[model samples]
Target: MLIVGEIHTALLPHSRPLTPEEARGALALAVGETVVQWARPVPHTASPTLLHGVDCRLPLGPKPGNRHADDAAGGSSVRAVGTVCSRAVLTGGHLLQGSAWTAVAPPQQPRRMPWSYYLARPGTLETIGNFEARRLAEGYLLADGQGKGLARKVRHDGGTALLDAAAIARHSVHDVLSRPVLDQRPPIKTGSTRLRWAAIADPGEGRAVAFRLVGNDRRRMSLVTGLVEPEQIAAAAEDLAVHDWLLSAVAARIALAKIGEDPRHTLRTLRPVVDHLLHLWSAGARTSRDLEFMWDSLERRPGLTRQWTTMTERVRSQIDYGAADLAAKMLDMMEERQKQTGGAGEPHYR
Candidate 1:
């Protein structure tokens, strides 16, 4: 079995973080399932899973404009029939994420199955016609340059089709963000991080997760692991996306600080990094123990927490310097006034 999903991470378009009660109202996407929240490590909330039925052609290539060899290898068109699972998540009660994931399993028979059969599986997708799960996984991780301002390039090749997991995630985000519950004004301006991941389930094999960060535009994460439920993979992906967003968000703030600029303005930009973002860097704190090694591997090299700590200290230093400068200037102004008045009795400097 193979599972593919995309996560869209963005700042909750609000000036303040939502309280636990408020977060509940924000994530109520279904009738029966309740939104789950965790308060200690960090304030986090997750909506109930929602299912979307898709009977579209599975995309054939790794990119929109490129063609996968498998497209021609199969010799005929392939269609996918199944449900894509989507949910909304909030971390630190401030970062909002829209995640959509689905499992792909071979059909009981060669031909397409009834929609009822697929629906019964909920978050699973059944393959129709001819499809290669490995090829589909490769294509998903490839960056096709899809996002704001970038035009999607379409491939007219006969071999492959496109799956709209990102679209499903975006729609979920739009639905919840539109609610009046949100403050609707962002505290800091930053770009969203898009993560598309695919996992191959092999219970006997050892568990492993590998990720390739494709430029700054998108990330492609592929996992080959021992038998694990689809929900577990989705949880690991969600946790990965959240920390990636925090690292990116804080890094952007550090770049924008411009130490050469006025200290006060620098402090203004860095305040949110310290108050809201710093505490959110506890990676793998909520991930499954099976996947903890993935986080460990990443931390050993790029060292996300280390980067965050360095950036945070820089911001704090700038703030301290700015505060001292402002105090000194105020004292100078008072002394100048006294000198101009020759310390006259109109009023004495306190």
Candidate 2:
């Protein structure tokens, strides 16, 4: 089984963090469905998932000896029919994301099924032909244009069409971002980040995961874990994508500043980190503990949170602390102390 999807994350196009009410309004995509919100760790909201129906050619997995999946074309078209699921997520009321994915399963029979048969299985795509998980992963995450070649062929043949999973996700997010709820002004000048992922759940007791930057704004992560709900798997991916985006965004900004030579430039570049993104370092909050070990694994090797901690300290300890007043800085220091020692007697935000 393969769960393949794309995620788009960016700073919410707004001047200030949205309240729960406004956040809920922005993510109310479905007419009668509920929009979920969480207040504890940080202000977070999830739009009710919306499903898009698709009956089209699925991307072929790589052929033997092929380095990429996109290269494995010119074969008979493989058809898949089902619905693709998409949803909008708002974290810290400032980070926006659109997520879309479909669970791909080998077909039960060898031939095409009726429309009702496929409609009964929402969010699942049953393929009509043979394929492998590895090929699907390569095709979806590594290939430059996932399903683009197949899409063109389907169009040339005048078949149903090929689904653009990433485009579907982008549209979902853009719909929310363009709504009247947003002020059309972003606090920072940053483009959206995309994370393309494929996950497989098995009967094992442990998890195996790999995450890499395919490009500056594009990322790919593959996950394997014990049996769990599809939503749980997607949630884990979403959490990873958000933290990865935050890490990449902050790291990029920090890379432009001088460390010890120019405190002024360092402070100027990093001020946005503190004001906009530092508090969002909280990861794994939305993930299942059974699979949350993936984050721990990432932190161990690449040290996701460790790097975040180091950079946050650097930003906080910058010369003159930028425009923050002395009292606010002292309070922040005390909060950090309490965070390290449970001094506040409440849940730690970081």
What C-alpha lDDT values do all the predictions have?
A: 0.77, 0.78
- TM-score of every prediction relative to native: 0.87, 0.84
User: All predictions: root-mean-square deviation over Cα?
Assistant: 4.5, 10.0
Query: Please, what are the lDDT tens digits per residue for candidate 2 over residues 1-350?
Result: 77888888888889889999999999998899999999979788999988777777655555778655444354434677778889999999999999988888888878888878877988888888885766666556644354442122345556755557787787779879777978888777776788888887667535788888876788888888777777788888889888988887777877776866666677777777778888887788999987887888898988888988887776677735544454577789878977887675545577
Runs in model 2 deviating more than 4 A are 63-77, 148-153, 159-162, 204-206, 258-265, 319-350
| Total clashes for model 1 | 7
Candidate 1 stretches greater than 4 Å from native: 60-77, 129-131, 143-161, 344-350
